[model samples]
Target: MSRARSVRSPRPLLGAATVVAAVATAGSLFLSLGLGLTPCRLCWYQRILMYPLVVVVGVAAIEERSGVARTVLPLSVFGLALAAYHSWLQVTQTTCSVGVVSCATVQYRLFGLLTIPNLSLLAFLLVTGIVAVASWRTRR
Candidate 1:
């Protein structure tokens, strides 16, 4: 007698979100390193949060572990908050002080509208939403 494999993996949504988070993290790195753009204080804070998320969620999703949500939840929420604040600072034009790196600097703009912070904020929001929904669905 042979043991059978399961029909499908159960955590597709989580897996996808984790992959997207990884992609987002890579994109941020590309913007900073490849494009020669420097990150400000808030950007550094956000990067600190986002970088780990890629690894934590990626491993959890690959293992189909239930504890993934518990680990990711607080990170996602805090990341979202940081992204939002960064975006707000960018929008308000009150980013840099006398000796600080300008958080409001729009290093690059796509279509003259989207900036670095904007992109970061958007990515965080999407990831957070996906994680929240996926966690809620899985718990049911």
Candidate 2:
């Protein structure tokens, strides 16, 4: 009789999530600083939720700490929700008048469809899913 064991490392999964967050953070900064795109209220909220994730998630991945799930999940989930709402506002042409620029204003779009909020939504979803899987693997 032979016994078989499956070995899985959560570090890779967390690392992927860290990369996602880092890219998203950099992209957002580039859009604002490089391109001079003004961030709306919702965009600012999403940024607030996402920016810290780079440090938090990156540290967790580097330290190989699965406990990061507790922090990452909440922030990512909130960011996802904000991004979704922002996307909806843009799609519906509803302007959220909170800052200098309207939230519904689409400064630019990729492929004439993908907006900034869309990218934010995707990034949050990826980080959320990856961190969740890493946490699950750690538990199992």
Candidate 3:
């Protein structure tokens, strides 16, 4: 009896995801630089989590390492959590009274309703979801 062998590679999904992340990161950086909008401390923290994802996902895509998926997914999840909280604080207009930085003073609403932190939150969720889905589809 002969056994069937798989013919597909997982590199495409990883590569695509990486590209998406990198583009989004670049866009965010451009928005910060091109526009005069300064990032708050929490925004910086979220960036710390997001920037690495571009490299990690790119490398993993090229290498096609199973272990990379496992590791990267968790990091993305952490980023998602941070971004979500930051968004919530901004949208709610709640003050970070205890912290050195004030969330309330950060100008939560942008373009009338969309907040800067809200953008970060959405990006985090999208990136994390993509990574999770791609990782799950990856071959062992």
Model 2: per-residue lDDT, tens digit, 1-140? 22222245677888899899999999999999999998888899999999999999889988888889999999999999989988999989867777888989998797888899999999999999999998887788
Clashes of each: 0, 0, 0
| Tens digits of per-residue lDDT for model 3, 1-140 | 22222223456767777876787688678767877566677777777877888898888878865457677777777877887787777668767763566754555455777676676777777767776676566543
lDDT of model number 2 = 0.90
Q: Where does model 2 exceed 4 Å of error? A: 1-6
Error of 3 at 89 (Å): 0.7
Q: Which residue runs does candidate 1 get wrong by more than 4 Å?
A: 1-10, 98-100
Considering lDDT, which of the candidate structures 1 and 2 is the better prediction for this target? 2
Root-mean-square deviation per candidate: 3.5, 2.9, 3.9
Of the candidates shown, which would achieve the greatest TM-score relative to the real structure? 2
Best by the lDDT measure: 2
* C-alpha lDDT of candidate 3 relative to the true structure: 0.70
On TM-score, who's better, 1 or 3? Answer: 1
lDDT of 1 at 76: 74
